[model samples]
Structures are given as C-alpha cells and as structure tokens.
Target: MNLFMSFLLLFLLYTDKLAGLNFNTDVTVTWGQSHVAKSRNGEEMEFKMDQYSGASAQTNADFLFGRFDMRVKLNSPDSTGTITTFYLHSPNRDLWWDEADFEFIGGSSTADYKIHTNLITDGIGNREQQFRFPFDPASNYHTYSFFWTPQQIIWYVDGIPIRVYRKLSDSRILYPDKQPMKVYTSLWNSTAWTGEVNWKNAPFSAHYRNFYVNACVAWRDGSNVSSNCKIVPPFWFTYKLLPLERDMIIRMREQYMTYDYCNDKEKVTDVTSIECANNP
Candidate 1:
C-alpha cells in the first residue's frame, strides 16, 4: 500500500476497534455542580475550578475488575497547582480503602505535563510513580487507562502501556484484588504539593471525555457475568509484550519520566522487586 493508503488503513482499523464510550450517568457530582458543565455537545465533561471553587465527579456504582479509561485535556497557559484526578477505590476508609490513582500535578505550560500514578493497598504508605508527558496534553485529548485483573495491573496512555504492576510476587506486599472499586474523577486545588499559590496560577480547568469500561459489570457482585452488560477483556492482557511494551516504556521513561519509587535510592534495598527488573 502507498503511504497515504497505509496511514488511512491504520486509522480506520484503530477507530473500528475503538472501545465504546460510556459516561457514568449514575455518577455523583461530589461537589461544585456550578463549576461543572457538559460540553463537546455532551460528549465531554468540562470541570472547572477557580480561587473560589472546584469540581468533582465519581461513579455511583462499584465494579470488581475492568479496564477503565478517560480521555483528558489539561488546562493550558498556566496549569500549575490545580490537580486533576481519576481513580478507583472502595468506600472503605482508613486501612481498608483500596485505591489506584492517576493524578495530573499540572505544569506551567501545555507542553509540560506531569502525571503521578499510585497504588494504595489497604490504606498503607503511599506507593507513588511519576512521569512527565512530552506532548502538550492541553492541545488535544489523550486517553488514560487502567487495566485491573486477577493477575496484574497495567497503566496506559493512548493505548500504549506505560507501567505495569503485577499481582504481588513478594509475600511482603499486598494487592487490591478482593474488593470492587468506584471510579472517581475530580478537579481541585493541589497547591500544597504542587507549589505555593504563586507557583500555581489558579483559575484552571479540566476536560474529561466519555469514560469507557471494557469488562462485564457482574464481577462486582461476585459473578462471572452481568445481566445488563456483556463484554471481554482487551487483547493486551492475553499476549506477552515484554519486548514491545518494554521498549515503549523505556523510551518514555528515558525522555519524560520524572520520578519512580522503584528507583528511589533509599527505597531500593537488600531486597528488590522483579517488577522493577528493567522489564514491563
């Protein structure tokens, strides 16, 4: 095929395979309804926050295991301090709360996007992994996704695997496989960790497109199927891609990664995790 034909073919194939988008209409607007608006002709959820207020939204129901995705565009111009978040967790508070988080720490320019990922098992010490996206997220929309399963967890950006945390290979660590979790999204002031008010120009906004769930919902109720939903896990889980996925992760980390807990000098100890064995 010619170059043009090849490009077109790829585009068509990608779109044809595009996952279905679903908004958690049953979702709850945790706060600041006045600051939230539906735009993109209802295809996108625009969340805004100023010096006076912020906005948040969370799924009303819980899902046991699934691939959750959200296309997002961070606020441009000056996006410091304002934090935009997407996560999954159960209602259990304190030591029982199980959470997996994708947090945008904001940057001064559209070209500099700092993303922080974390997994909180049983409300324990923070296990944070951070990266900086080279592309200008504010210029357009990019899909961020979380794939949760009985064996492992994979984090993806634009369909490319960025990080993979396996189900605990070590007896010392805990995994979040037992409880179902609700999907959560929020936009609020994070100047404390981001920086002072002066460093994080306020009055920023967050844009979230339709969320896509790629698994049967019945898993939440302790069954293999759902009465109202029918679906299967995506192909990424079934194949072995250490060669390809590892290269993608290495390229991104070499150029864009900012911090990783696995590489922390103090944290890397007499014992090491095979997950950090320079493999994905």
Candidate 2:
C-alpha cells in the first residue's frame, strides 16, 4: 500500500471509521432468505451459498442520487465460483435499464482477484472496466463507494478515486443520470463468467459491513426536485477531482487496470463510444 492508503486504513481502524455493524434489519433480502446468515464474529451480514442455492439482498427503497459506501471483505479460502457483487440496479428495466456494478470475479488465488466495474444505460451495458488492486482484497476489509450525480459517476475504493465517468455529447448514448436505483448485493454462481460454479467444495461466504448512504435530490436536467429535498450547494456533488484523486486515477489505469471496453479496438472497430472519445 502507498503512504496515503496506509495512513487512511490505520486511521479508520483506530477511529471507529471501519467498525463492523450488524445488518440484521438494515437491509431486505430479495432472494434466498434461507441462505442469509450472520458472521460468526457478529460483525457483518454474511451471504452464504452452497451447491443447492444462492443468496442476494438489497436496500429497502430506491434512491434518486446519492453516495453509497459499502465496506466488504471477500471470501478467503477456496473462493472459486463465489461471485460477490455490490451494485445499483434501476427499477425501470422494461422501459430502460440503468445500473452500476462492482463484480468481484472468482479466481483460483488472491493474485487473480479482479474488480469488474460497469455502467449500464438504456439496457446497453458495454461500459466495462476491470482492475487489479495492489493489496489482497480477501486479506482485509475495504470500503468501496460510488458518488453519483447529474454530472458524472465516480468509483472509489478505500477513499481513493479509481474511475470517473461523465456524460457524453451524443444524445443517443444513454447515461445513468435520470433514473432511480436500488442498492443490491448478491453471492451467486457465475460459471459463465467466473469459470465454473465449483460447488463440490460447497459453503462460500461473503461478508458485508458499514453500509452508508448520503443522499441528495439530484436530477440530470434543471427540473423539479422532490418535496422533502433540501436545497444543496453546487459544490456538494461534482466530478471536480482533487490532486490525490487525479493521481489515484492515473495510478490505477497505469498500473492495475486490466480491461477497458472503450479502449478495446477490436470491440469498437467501426463504432467508437462517444463517452470514451469525449472523456479522453
């Protein structure tokens, strides 16, 4: 870890910033309630799965726009076929689907841990980017958060910026700025993506703690705000990057970023993504 990251983790550990919280009532189980189990240490809500079934859950309500943070520790021993996800999904999927994803792809060892991030708009979810962290994700707990606003979407891990996605100039490209979404986390079998659902070993568990949401009544355009929404400052939500934030983005892309769909020439041979061209 870098100097800044080390200090941040130390501070969090000592200052109750990363103190584990019980989520017995904080969330709602959307599916596989029988598989929902708490951790042995009582620190977090554990989503356990076996060969027979999988588990998934989500927050109670849909949020307009907010900063959602989740501190999680991935499965450690024999984590193969355990696909852990923390993401936001749009309610209006039939009309148009908009979503944000953080998929921890299953691998043989800790060295193979890849964090897959994506944004789906208008049911087109090609905006995919995968990354590798310097530290072993299974070794310790880390906070992953997303800052969503009318301007852009920013992904952060351990308080450091990893990716920033902004709106494109083209009207055809649908951005995730207009719809409401609900937070969801799931532990399931993703054999098509995560190799095979290795169930012979059975019993895969994922831990989650400290789910926080700082909300706002944001909209893409200058439009009607919600009734209970309070007036907010302009600087409250913007993609204005700090010095360290900019540095982290560069560092992640240069050192750890593995796959970016926009940059793949073969994928976008004839039709380049407007979001990629404009952002770059």
Candidate 3:
C-alpha cells in the first residue's frame, strides 16, 4: 500500500509540473522602433505610442501550427485607433513563403479583429477577413488568443472563442503547410480604415499594457533549436492543403496580390502577363 501511495504522489507532482510548463509566461518583445533588440524584452519595451510615430512589438517563436495568446490594454486617451497584431514572416527567399496574422485595428474603445493569409511564389497570394470582438479593449486588459493547426484557425476574445476558420482553404494539399513564423504585436494608427472614428478627439498617446505572449508547437519532424525561431510542427502535415493545387485559392491570392501591388483590383479577363496573372 505504501509503495502504491508513493507512486500516486509522484504522479500528482508530475501532473502539476506539466500543467505549469504548458502555459509559460515567457515574453519576448520586439519594438518597431529601431533601437530595440530583435528577440529580447525589458522595461523599456512596454507598449507606448504617440502621434509622432507608431510603436509595435513582436515575439520570436516561429512555428507552423501552435497556440498564441496575449493580454492587452489600450490607453483611453489614444483610443482614436489602435492596432495589435500577431504575424509571421519569411526569413529566406528561396523557399516559398507563407504568412498568417491576426490584427486588432482602429483606435476606438471597441476594436476590429482581422485574419490574413499570404502565399508567396513569384510575388504573393493574399486573402483577408474581419470580425467584431467584445471587450472595450481600451478600458481594461483582455486576453486575445489564436489556435492554428493543420485543419483550422481559431481566435479568442478575452478567453471566449470568437472566430474559427475551418474552411478557409482552397486546396487539399501543399498550402505552405510546413513553415515557421514568429509572433508579433504592435499598436499603430488606423489611417487605412478608421475614418468613422474621431481621431482629432483622441489623445496623442496610446498604450498597450500587460502585454503577454505564449507559444507552443504541438509536433515537429525535422527541426533545429534556434533562439529566435522554431521549426514547423509535424502536425501541419495533416492539412495537406497546397494553395497551388486549388484553382480558387490560387485565383483569390493572385487577385489580391495584383490589387495590393499592381493596383489591379478588377479581374482582367484576358489581358497581359497571362503567366503572371494565372500561374502560381
């Protein structure tokens, strides 16, 4: 009986330790300002911005599929528009690049959340969608989170699941399924979309406080241990979604890329650069 009880005690202790490790509070802040380190954090990096320029911060963990969480509080006076972002980038140009992001934009007591995806070959294939989230993000600190896996992408507002994208794919395989992306956050002015809000009334200063970030990779196959980046998790293999294979996803990405860079918003039914227009 004593032996059995001892094993039980050990099991309980291990469980507690594992639970603690799963939700670590390690924060790495990267400021948009040039002075900040690329993957380190300190008191000076706490979120604060003014009219002169915008301030932003990002974390270093880069993974293809994982959970990302952060708590943010916006300053009331600067509520004209605030943008909190989570994004990933391509370090090298040789490999086709893939990126996904969650954006909290507009400087109001209320905020709008957006999700964007980009697949890069010659240029970029892009898609974006938006939704509303509760929490007067300017008043109090609230947790904003995302869960990305091979099959779906989910978002949370203050711990409540607000959005889920299970069908945002246009292909069944090769959708940049295996790629690494770092975590990023920033507070910026919403000049692009906040025309409805009264910017003049907003104080020049906006703040993001109690900023926190946590990341974990559910699985990995061939990965190296790097300080600022992580290898793509193995689970992404399940997605089997290749943007190039799907006609619609590829078309959508091409349209957006043309519009974003070439300013070609209209679909050119039969025009120039046929290869550039339809070849992914």
Which 10-residue window in model 1 sums to the lowest lDDT?
221-230
Q: How many clashes does the backbone of model 3 have?
A: 17
TM-score for candidate 3, please give it. Answer: 0.53
Candidate of highest TM-score: 2
Using Cα atoms with residue i matched to residue i, what is each candidate's TM-score against the true structure? 0.81, 0.83, 0.53
Q: Tell me, what's the RMSD of every candidate?
A: 4.6, 4.9, 11.3
What C-alpha lDDT values do all the predictions have?
0.72, 0.74, 0.44
lDDT string, candidate 1, 1-280, tens digits? 6644544454355345545544435567889999988753546788888878889988766776667878998887877777899998876666677899999887677656688998887886456788888677888889898877767677888876778777656766668876678888899887778864443455678899867775435434444324223355544335233445666777887877888877887766433455466334
Question: What is the C-alpha RMSD, rounded to one decimal, of candidate 2?
Answer: 4.9
Query: Which candidate number has the best lDDT?
Result: 2
lDDT of 2 by residue, 109-218 (tens): 77887899998887887778999867888888898988777777889888777888776666775678667787899999887767876666678877888777765533
Candidate 2 worst ten-residue window by lDDT: 13-22
Please write out the lDDT profile of model 3 over residues 147-235, one tens digit for every residue: 55656554555543433445333342233345555655566666666544455654333333333333343233456433222454333
lDDT of 3 at 261: 23
Candidate 3 lDDT score at position 197: 41
The candidate with the higher TM-score, 2 or 3, is 2
